[model samples]
Target: MLKTAAAAATGSALSSLGLRAASASTPRRGGTLRIGLGHGNSTDSYDPATFIGGFMQAFSFARYNCLTEIAADGSLAPELAESWEPSSDAKQWVFNLRKSVEFHNGKTMDAQDVIASINHHRGPESTSAMKPVVDQIAEIRSDGPNRVILTLEHGNADFAYTLSDYHMVIAPAHEETIDWQSGVGTGGYVVDSFDPGIRAALSRHENYWKENAAYFDNVEMLTIADANARISALLSGQLDVIDRIPFATASRVKSLANVKLVEVTGSQHYSFAMNTQFAPFDDNDVRLALKYAIDREKLVQNVLSGHGRVANDHPIGPAYRYEATQLEQRVYDPDRARSLLKKAGHDSLTVELSAADAAFSGAVDAATLFREAAASAGITINVKREPNDGYWSDVWMKKPFSAVFWRGRPTEDWMFSTVYIGKSPWNDTFWENESFARVVNEARTELDEGRRRSLYAEAQALVRDEGGAIIPMFANYLSATNLNVEHPERLAASDDLDGMRLAERWWFKS
Candidate 1:
């Protein structure tokens, strides 16, 4: 729906990124897989709360395991927790942990460890993003050695899916506090070294519980925020895997037979977020004007180089459950945009929109394109290029209007609760739809599939037409990998690089 360019252009663009074809190769173990990632900061911490991009997730998978994980095909699969079930009302849940899973520190995973890890984000001093998630839990206690029970304030049919969140990684517990600096977990690999924004090293855990994964003997995850640098690393035989490949340069990367680009369509959405509390943007009509002024199709075709699909002003892409598919896509209309601006008591409105490539692959270019399109609608948008180093902390939500990207949550309720909820710290737009809040709560507890679907459909409509984020495109996860790196046919679209499990599932084709 990107309202973007022609399909041929998209195909031509993707040909370079490796989505044009698939390969059949067998997995062989015992090789070091060097990975180059496109996002991270020197301030990055070992705490799961500090995770900012796919780079962190990839690194965490090297030493930690969540209760569940998102599979290559987007299904939730058990990890540390062997089995789980919910109460009749779905307000209470119990997880049976796998026994004898040992950490690198010689500690066995137990119910107490799980309880302590959950409490880390629940403590009063905790400022974790997962705080809101665990805040819903009234109690987390152990019934026995391998049994853990979680009592919720309300029913959540998808509560199990919540455990799949990367922030919920289970770490060793000591005196009600989690000892994460040790970086020990029952994962496929053990952390040999970690330097946040620079590079990380991990070696395969000989005692890893999962018998089928962690094929590589070692892995090195490098944070290269520059696209040029990431590409150069892959082309020059420096990295075996790299993600966030630029859409415009897909062809250049694809032409290399030793490497292939991987594209998986999912819930990733790119937007120019407006501070709904600010002027001009605070007015719904003005927001609508800005929305109508941007050409989504051209953005997908020209700016995204057809590597994405047009979004309908909402973060929930078509891959999301209960998406409002029947809703008419918002189209480009400069005259209508001008009319809306005039109605908002502004014949012409001038605003500064800060952006950087780190916001998305080509955000500066997209903002420039938007500026050209809005000029016809009597709107002057000054595209301010902000530095990528502090864009996340400085310009993203701090500015009145700026660019942001949402990888999206596994569930609709999770997505809304994480970003759109009025109290969420990541509520970049400061949008609070009263009806949507009520509907999301209902959908979370509604066990009736039909009723839940209806509730989500209503919620999606409100976000698409009235939300504060101007979602221009739902992009496919694009990454370039070497010919020797072998993974599953269906890869993870929810999280980059096979759900950041490349170290676990991939192998060298020797």
Candidate 2:
């Protein structure tokens, strides 16, 4: 007998949990901050030119300063640069650097430092995630000691916003080495010591330009790979702050008196990506059928404990303007799914579902939920869970079929280029659509907001209709902090950790 829809959706094999609530009191100052980082993926690099993930982002926060910083409201604000103005044609951007700003190594910040940093990312063999943004620049030259000029290939209204990217942070030009251990930046703090993938210690920079910044005298960031271990550390008072708390444990943590949970609706989506160039998923009907078979709401509630939001047909969230609201929501229907599979000449379909143990907050439990849901729809899903070591290189980026965790990007163009674009470095799905490509390229070049929005809307529609990616839910970026520390009222919207956690501003009240 086929499993009933309600029974299939509500199947439970795991215990439930909750998030810790915030205490009612003001913050005090002066204490050594110990933060538990979720995990340190090998993707962590100090080159700024090629860094990815929260580890690098967290490290960069104290190591470098950008010309312009993105405000909490998404506006571009001056950081290292005092101010900036665009030329009449909108092609050239002239920035006035802050003269009093000095690097941690006692070197004064100048336009030459900005030029060198930008050029380093633009050069070959660079690993900077901001490379794409700098690729549009025709030239970056120092106009004077305190002035820098940027000539873009075309007029881009978002050029200033691009400068606000964490990876675009300026570095010292005279540094003999790129070790990053020397702590030669103009940021709020300076790196005291760094033991890769283990621990990183930082101290407040005495010469920080921003007033009352770097409130904590010392910060020790520990890389804790296991969710339970991190949670234990937080609850036991071993950690002052912890990030990426598991959904299952959120409620339990919230119940505690000392912990304060901060839930920011992330731009990220956790989904199973099928290779369109490969066998079974090559057919659109098979892909759609698979998507229809999985009970996503159940996974969100049961596995993720309803801490996440459901993705509207596409991965891009409501925070972006181009999301398609008209597309039909992909609900689970085992009957329809089975019918499609049988029509495609497979009465019983078997597929491999690969996942990484430490990829998501509750990934192991989430995969089991998927297994049960697929089984109810007459599909045999063989689960393969890999360890944290080399999982990205061996299972995710290299494998043809896999379940991957993706942190949501800020812009629609960034999401398209990174994941769906043909031959992209991180394009694991390997979907190649000529029309989709055309739409994205056009959207990138279109300066008019209305025209670009329309183009992106069309592209999102195409991805939902033709793409093989099954976006289950939009995961929430969870951070738990001690009530004794003063955090920013608003956090960065992007899941990228660099700007999201204002560690520099956090002060421990006594």
Q: Give the top-scoring candidate (TM-score).
A: 1
Q: Which lDDT value does model 2 have at 143?
A: 78
TM-score of each: 0.94, 0.87
Candidate 2, lDDT over the whole model: 0.71
How far off is residue 240 in model 1, in Å? 0.8
1-510: candidate 2 lDDT, tens digit per residue: 011211121112000111122432244445688988876765565667666667667777766788876554434567888878876545788889999788888888888888887787775555455665576789878878999999988765446656666677788875532434355788877888877778888888878888856777788888898878888898888988888887888898788898877776656688888888887988877777788788889888976799787764467775454566666777888888888888777887888877876667766677777778878779888888877777766787566567778776556776776678775656778888999988987786675657877888889888887886888888877778777655655555555332444566566765
Q: Per-residue error at 399 for model 1, in Å?
A: 0.9
Q: Supply every candidate's count of residue pairs whose N, Cα or C atoms clash at under 3 angstroms.
A: 9, 21
Number of the predicted model whose lDDT against the real structure is largest: 1
lDDT digits (tens) for residues 1-510 of candidate 1:
110111122223222322223665777779999999998788888887667678888877778898887665555667998878788778998899999999888899899999988888785676787777778899989999899999999998777777878788889888858888777777888888888789999998998888888999999999899999988888899999999999898878878778888877777889999999989889999999999999999999987788789999877765565677787999999999999998999989999999999899999999999999999999999999999998987888899999888888877778888888777768999998888889888888887768988998888788877889899888878898888788876676666787778889888887
Residue 323's lDDT in candidate 1: 73
lDDT of each: 0.83, 0.71
